[model samples]
Target: MAVEEILERLTRGVRDMDEELAAEAAQDALANQMPALTAINDGLVRGMNEAGRLYETQEYFVPELLLCSDAMYAGLGILSPHIQRAEEESRAKVVIGVMQGDTHDIGKNLVKLMLEVDGFEVFDLGRDVTPADFVAKVKETGAELLGMSTLMSTTMDAMGVAIRMLQQEGLREQTTVMIGGGPISQAFADLIGADGYAENATGAVREARRLLASRGAAVR
Candidate 1:
């Protein structure tokens, strides 16, 4: 099949939530020497955008969205190895985690995957992470960005505590902070002094780039 046909199939596979087809199409794209980045962006990401639209229209619910995301990631796993990152040796490092007392991670995982596919090296700290742990990781890894997630309104305060810890430890200037999850909002992010807020994985990638650029740092 032609590259266009393969990419189209990949896109359809994702929209249909056919993980096997998406992965197969990705392999075909690789075998045909299609640019992995092209396959990911023009194919999987495009399909995900369509899924997002469907979700907004209420044509697709959480289960369907999750399935679509699974299909997208199936293709991503196949194409990721072939994608050549421009600054592989010094890719921007990002530290991510779910805040203390909150264990939800589906959204956090998706954000990490999207960030990685966009060429950012992510250090995922998993769920229920403490403020000290977040601060220590930034200081230890010298990461340029810190991303926090929480599904509960109660645990939201953990993000603020983490940021304050960073400030007290003198690490705030060296790292940018972004937040997301079920109970988070732009106003809350602003109140917590976050650098940015994203509603979903796609927005997270864009926001991460904008935040990095605003800090005079390179996104890749």
Candidate 2:
């Protein structure tokens, strides 16, 4: 199939929720004769954007969104290494994770994946992580940005704990904190003294980039 046709089919697969075809189309794009990066990146971002809209409107739940994300990943896996090498000098480094007691990681994982696609280096801490661990990772990695997730109201306090710990240890001045999750909000993020608050994955990337840029980070 022609590259245009393959990209068109990929778009249709995502719009129609044909998971199998979406995956296949991604692979075809990978193996196609011409430059695959532009087409695959466009299709991947478009599909993920559609999924984000579906999620925001409550038209699709987590499982379906996850599947669409999987399709995006199918394409992104091909692009990310190239994207990273394209910027081997460095784009940016980020530390991301879910807070302690928050075992859920869907939102956090999505943010990590999307950020990586955008060419930012990410260090994921998995789930059930403490504030000290987050701080330690930041200190060790020298990440430019720190992103945190808390899915439950009960664990929301952990975001503040992490932020305060940063301030206490003088890391706050060096690393910017970007916090989010179900219970997280702009007001609360301010209350916790986070550098930024993202309502969702895209916003997280945008905010993190903005904060890092303002701080004159390598990539903003």
Candidate 3:
């Protein structure tokens, strides 16, 4: 299959949210018959961009976005190791999670999938991640960005605690922290001393890349 054909097929599946077709597209890429990295990337991520826009415009809700994200991940997973080589580069590493005392994970999960498509190697800490654990992962993985998610006002302080712990632990110099969730705000992030905050998952990815570029992998 030529890159053009591969692109058309893959994008069609993504726009339609057809997981089986997306899988087939992955198989085609794995086969590497046409060397179509850009085609594959655009199909996977452009579909996601559409889904994100739909979510922002209220044309689609969280459930729909979640499903679409799943579809995108399915395709990206098949392209995982090849995405970098085929695309000729790799993005930086990032750690993402839902904060301690917060059980919500849908937002963080979506952010994870998109960042993967964008070529970031994401280490997901999952739900109920403690400040100590967040700091430890930064040390362990040498990740440039640490993304925290919290859905409750009560648990929002946990995000701050994670940042402070990183500082007190003397590891804040190595990691940039970004927080998100319904109850979080830019103002709250500043008060909490987070390096960045986003209104949504897409903003998180954008802010994360920017932080990594300017800070040279240091935050606090």
Collision count for each candidate, in order: 0, 0, 0
TM-score of each: 0.85, 0.83, 0.87
Q: Could you say which candidate leads in TM-score?
A: 3
Ranking by TM-score: 3, 1, 2
Between candidates 2 and 3, the one scoring higher on lDDT is 2
Candidate 2 Cα errors over 4 Å, as ranges: 11-17, 34-36, 77-84, 87-89
lDDT of 1 by residue, 75-150 (tens): 9889988878751446899999999999999889878867876678899999999999999999999999999999
lDDT digits (tens) for residues 182-217 of candidate 3: 999999989988889888877777888788878865
Task: List model 2 lDDT by residue over 88-120, tens digit each.
Answer: 446688999999998999999989977875668
Pitting candidate 2 against candidate 3, the one with the higher TM-score is 3
Q: Considering only N, C-alpha and C atoms within 3 Å, which residue pairs clash in candidate 2?
A: none
Overlapping backbone residue pairs in candidate 2 total 0
Deviation in Å, model 2, residue 151 alpha carbon: 1.9
Local distance difference test, candidate 1: 0.89
lDDT of 2 at 34: 35
